[model samples]
Target: MSAGSRVELYAAIRRDARAGMSGRELQRRHGVGWRTVQAALASAWPAQRAPYPPRASKLDPFKPVIDQILVVDLDTPRKQRHTITRIFNRLCAEHGMTDVSYPVVRAYVAQRRPEIRTEHGRTESAAFVPQTHLPGREAEVDFGEISVRLRGELVTLHLFSLRMSYSGKAVHRVSATGGQEAFFEGHVHAFKVLGGVPAGRIRYDNLKAAVAQVIGFSRQRVETDRWVAFRSHFNVDAFYCQPGISGAHEKGGVEGDIGRFRRNHLVPVPEVDSLRELNEFIDDYDRADDDRRIGHRVHTVGEAFAAERQLLKPLPVEPFETGLWMTPRVDRFAQITVRSNRCSVPSRFIGRQVRVLLHASDLAVYDGRTPVASHERLLTKGACRLELDHYLEALIRKPGALPGATALEQARAAGAFTTVHDAWWAAACKAHGDADGTRALVEVLLLHRHTPHEHVIAGITAALRAGALTADAVALEARRAAEPIDSAVPEADGHTAILTPDAAVVASLTHRRLTHLPADTRPPPTVTAYDQLLRQTTS
Candidate 1:
């Protein structure tokens, strides 16, 4: 019977006894035993049950062997340690204890293994202690691997998360790499997002980006020089936890935050065209998370953060340069190698050393402060990112190479080189042989630097319709495309001059008045009148 039912029965029996009823009569009325009636009458409650005597198990004889194995296993690697089956088999083979079942050994080992570990100081719970953080003083940083579909290509990206301990406010950024550049950039972004830096200390693991080497088993770590400089610049105080699994719990808040954010926002595997766009989405989600309450806290995350924001240390006035700097020699391919991936520069950079600033998602190449080229960071090793505009000079000279060039293929894939270009190229080739036609197209491609893309496309279309395959003709048409259709210039010399408003689009103004002038049909300005004068003179 349940405790409530027993208590109710006891109360009913007491009430009947209060009316002077006999114990046997109470038992018959309540449908309980005489002993229960007596006990209920004696104390008005159920008596505590008696304890049973200790009993022996079938595996009691092998208890010593199991203890010995477990004791030894405390020092052994986890994978190489003995299992319950191993213990049972060992007992049967060596101790000749046959009749013992696997369950008997399993129960004893399961109960005893943890006791052995605790006796040897191996349990993690023994070291766990609840911690309270001062507002805006403590934070945790962690990086997790997240997957996303970028432009229909599935890629794994590194997510850097910084979570405030007091308010549970977090700032997250996705990076193409988990390197130091990204590490520094994440810090910068997080600080700006939070509006300040932690005043006391931020907790972290022994990531290679920060910690160079952990000294012995203590908290002292030899930090990387760049990390040291970064800390100095931002006035940051870093507190590293113990190494390995033991250290994971030190920053457990951010660890849990990573999993939570990924599940709540990234579970469906977001598709994006670029990292910048993906980060913007992340920023929105992070702000939305502020409305959520953490655990049973009285205030929401945003409410708590409002109070903590004032306590945080002020940000530095000067921004730190987070991009990594490298000097790479441009190879024969007119590309420079960065972390095994290659990015193209202008062909003039070939055989020359160029300074490159490599960031988390892109890189900019410079020739002594003059920015030569820049590209989105390549994710795959040994993969090349090229721009067709970079090799225009060489490709024009060798038009045959254009068809097979990697740059052209990349341009077509990027939609920078369109079908109109192809159609125009085909017509140009048919009109003026293959070599000359490609050169004309190259000249048209060069016009992009001077004219807007829409104007250039208009020019190409107009040139094709007018059957003008030359680059000069395309330039003139492109300039015309940029002008207003309703606009007209002053009529001069029996010709209408349609001048381009933007003189830089072309060399000189073009005249269209001559075409609009009426043809002379009166006498064709014939010399018959002059012929009559000559006849009279001859007479």
Candidate 2:
């Protein structure tokens, strides 16, 4: 009923009429309605009976080419090549046809091509291979390679995906490096997405992510300990397809799914700026895909997953630790390099063995069973740094004897000691010419470990005021005090003064007399000679 079909019908009807064929015969030959043949005949020759309106042609431009290719290739052997692909290639290259897309070209070629004949010239059954699937019983897993632009560089990323066959629900996770970590991460994400694990089994190809070696038809040697732990944790059975033969009908669903997802979602090479942006876009895509119902099913993928939630086993009490474990030798500096980042342990641990846990973004240093320190993963290689503050007490005890003592220098540059304390030490070194001052100041800074900053500042002020400008002097005074106390007490005339009622009364009277007098006030309160003698005697 399309325009191209109508044109072809008109041409066929005119040719048949000139050949003395009836309208019925024309209709049968061209597979058109009788009215369509009549209308074409009437429009071409009008002397006879007029028929109804003509049907339109759907593929007008390529019909003649399709017919010619089919006629010429009929006598050729079927194993030589595909005539359809040849026709399309010729149309685009030699004929310069740009509008003929692959699907449209395929449809035209299929219409003209004769059905395959058996040895006896009889037809054979050509039915589609139906996919074997059960509700909540089957899942397909695969890894797809995709190009993503991250941090101004085009990176080829591997996306591991799992999809339930019946519900068409899917979960996918991406990683820059396709390894055991990415593989397990994908499974974890898929379990989260499906809401529950599938009732039947998980199907996979013999990817290195899942299998170490194929020993037999029913056995596979898996290399990663974490992978074994993962399957054990989830309590789900895993089934791997034959190695290198990824074409089983049961697994073909995920194959087609990869093409569909790549075309519909990852077109133009997915130019995302960051991993987070790519993840958000992927989440939106998953939501949209989950909401769409397959065929006429009443339940969507999301709804189906929700219904199947209770069937899944509970997640392990502790989440799978996605880290690479390795035994690293602690250098003389008591440091280990993980992913090129330097992390330090206690100085006593030098030349000792330790375990390092290297994650995607962090490195955890462990001495025996105890965690010594953790640091952010460094992106670049070379001498990465860890602060000595993390092991300052241990380092201080060893002092110059400690390896990688630059940590101490870094602490000094950050002003870990007071300037006055430093000055007192320098002056003491000049006066007494010894490290006793430095040691004394170090003790003073240590004393402030539990003391408030303000209190330390007041103590330093008191020590300086009390003529303890050198480290030795300050230490002497501090030892004499011993107990923690406020150092901001006011001094008067080389003696500690106390406020009393008689003194308050005298001060108030003096203030009143001074205010009542001129701007340039004179002393108004004079201790009488007798009172002065009594105060001096009391002092």
Candidate 3:
């Protein structure tokens, strides 16, 4: 028997023995093993005079007072309000109530806690029609919370997801914050992944990012200006579902997708050293999800998307820059602060109105229609100081004129210029003096304006090796090297010199040419005539 059962058995045995009842009777009464009854009888605390019923709660008498306190202090925070122990002490000291124990007070408080319900208001369930959404016609968007180990810190990351209702296509991204900036960035990335914008309306939860207030299931209070601007830029309509009504049936496709992704991919929590690395891994996972098959469709999500790609709206000529636009006063230093990072305008812009275009990746400064400067977006919020390197060229040319450079000095002091061209300046200064080297380095930097940095560096190195270390010389060489060469060689003529053969007849002749006789030459004819005449006379 368990200890409790043993205790009960012991009590039952004691009760039966005091009543002069047998062990059998005790077992029958208590429903315990005979061994338990015998063991209880062996030894232990002295038996009580009579069996006692469970005691009534000591705080039962103070129930009315506790309820009255809760009624008056309903608005107070639970921790700040009177706790069980506190109430017990108060009762003993002030009310002369001493019987109530901590347990009794705790039970009484637990019973009363549920009775104090504060109602904000009742929300009506939205009436929704089960529309048969066509393929490529509708997409559902939502945000989920994920814990990611970023740079060794456990951060709550917002994962924005877009799921096509038909093909079950999904796009997911991790953002540090779940504000409008993150919302727009998520859309931008989702569009790129889909390779085009969806043709149908998008469904979204009544989040502050997309909606300003809940008017009803069909209508919402005025949308935020940022969201309106986004809708205008993308030329798509946004729809909102009733608050607190998110479920699998309403957005079943994406709801399941979020769970699947969370369980299969997000579990174990990804530990990434950098945001870029985390984003890269997310891209890979997105591609894998797009390539997977859904339902009974023989085609993969990528294939289905290919068929639907043509139906999507064409992207605008200039893609939307994800940012929150704001107007802030230029400080005496000609700088405006956004999320604590300072950005500078020309000193001329000081006291004058200028526009700040903030983006997830960059910050653009504009005066009227013309853009004044652009810088990479600052990730953290705080006094983001501007860097002088951003406007040094403009400042130097308009020296002493202020050029209305508001944030230039702030930007300068922010160490922005420290690294902008530090390496190039260092190299140039090392090779030459400060003025000449900086000028040369500036020219080298200018090369990057036209060519890639790698090519510029290579050209600089080549120039230094060839003894053309001056900025002008290096720049000229770089220009010449960049020109295209005619790779084809020219054609040649066919003519060649030749020597004529000599005759052998000259070999037979002496140094001087002898006079040749006519056809019947001299000696043979005279000898024959003299011999014939002598023979005739002797006969």
Candidate 4:
């Protein structure tokens, strides 16, 4: 029985004994033995049970063997370490301990493994001190993995996140890779989005972008030179957590922020056409997150940020350039290789040196001081980015190359060579031969440099409807579509010298801009009498 149950029984027995009830009668009433009733009546508290003496078990004889095996396992790799099942089998096979059951051997090994680890100097469970953060004093930065649908394909992207220590306000952006360049770019974008850098230190784990190596158990670090320069440029100090698992608590806010955001915003796995579009969605999510409150806080995150923003260090005058610059020679194919991926530039720049600036998600090529081409940077190695416009001149020269060119295929994929353009090309091909038609299409594409795309498309549609297969007809229609509505007159009441009836109607329409003129108070001029006098003179 439990001590409480025994105590209650004893109290009841004492009460019944005081009332002159016999011991046999008390045992019958309480459903207890006569001896138990007598003992309960005599003692005030419940009787204590005696301790049992030690007894031998089937596992006792095999304990030493189990301990020895575990000791040997300490030196071996963890995967090859001794399991309870292995120990049981060894006891039955090698030691000839048939009487020892699996459960007995398994239970003993479970209790002894911790002792083995303790002897080998493994650390015990971890504990952390709680912290209080000052407003705008610090922030924690980390990168998390996320899956997004980019250009109709599912891709895993690295989400760079920063959380303020006090306000719980955060900013997140998606990067193509978690490389050093992306790390730097994430910071630059975060600082700009937050409006300033934290005056106090920012906490980080030993991410390779920042730390080159950790020095011993002291938690000191050897930071990368680029990281040092980046921090110095921003005039902010950094605090790195201990090298590994021990440092997780140091930046716990951002660690939790990443999870909270993923659960709330990224659960549906955002679908977007480009990385730019995905980042824009993230930007919107960050803005919407301002309405949320941190635990037990009186104000919303946005409210807290308003007060904390003033305490932050002012932003630098010029934005930090967040990309790598390289000089690459345009090859015979009019392409420059960046990170083993090919992106085309203008054919004019072929066989010439060009400056390439590779950013986190895009790249731009410059010829001397002029930008020659820009393309979304391809993260995949050996992938190519070709523009049809880049090869148009060459295609015009070698008309046979127009149909099967890589640039032509890319143009179709990018929607630059639209169905309307295709329809116009087919009609032209039927009117003129294939080579002449392709040359004509290339000529029309060159006009896109000077004319708006929608205007040209509209013109193409009009010419197609009119059965005009010539590029000149399409250009005329497109130019007409692009022309602005004539809302006002250019000349000041000086034109329109002839006052015919149609001219009078136009003059009436012009009255809106010519409101300063007096109303026509005099009688209308007699042009009919003048016409009759001219008729008599002619007769």
lDDT of 3 by residue, 270-367 (tens): 99966667778888888888778877779898887777777778777787768767777777666787776776665667777777877544568888
Looking at model 2, residue 187 earns an lDDT score of 79
Better of 3 and 4 by TM-score: 4
Q: Where is the poorest 10-residue window by lDDT in model 1?
A: 502-511
| Model 4 misplaced regions, further than 4 Å | 1-30, 33-126, 212-222, 295-300, 303-307, 483-539
lDDT of 1 by residue, 1-539 (tens): 88788889999999999999998899889898988988898886777667898598778888998999999998899899998888888999999998878887888899999998889988876466799988989999999999999989999999999999999999999989998988999999999999999988999999999999999999999999999999999999999998998779889999999999999999899999999999999999999999999999999999999999999999999989999999999999898999999888999878999999999988999999999898988777899899999999998889998888999999999888999899899999999999999999999999987799889999999899889988998898898789655335445466766656553322223345565578867855578799999999999
Reference-based TM-score of each model: 0.80, 0.46, 0.48, 0.75
Local accuracy of candidate 4 as per-residue lDDT tens digits, 1-539? 89898899899989989999998899899999978987886787977889898788977877898889988987899799877888888888998998877878777788888988897787476777688889989999999999988877888889999899999999998988787778899899889988899989899999998899989877689989888888888987889888667688889899999999999999898888999888898999999999998889899999999999999998888767778889999899999898989999889888999998888788888877788899987767899999888988888888888888999888888888899999999998988999999888888888899999999999999999999888898897888779643444445656634334323223344554477677779987768988999999999
- Number of the top-ranking candidate, with TM-score as the measure: 1
Q: Indicate the TM-score of model 2.
A: 0.46
Best by lDDT: 1
Better model by TM-score: candidate 2 vs candidate 4: 4
Indicate whether candidate 1 or candidate 3 has the larger TM-score.
1
What is the Å distance of residue 111 in model 1 from its true position?
Answer: 8.1
For all candidates in order, the CA lDDT equals 0.90, 0.67, 0.69, 0.86
RMSD in angstroms, all models? 9.9, 16.2, 21.1, 8.9
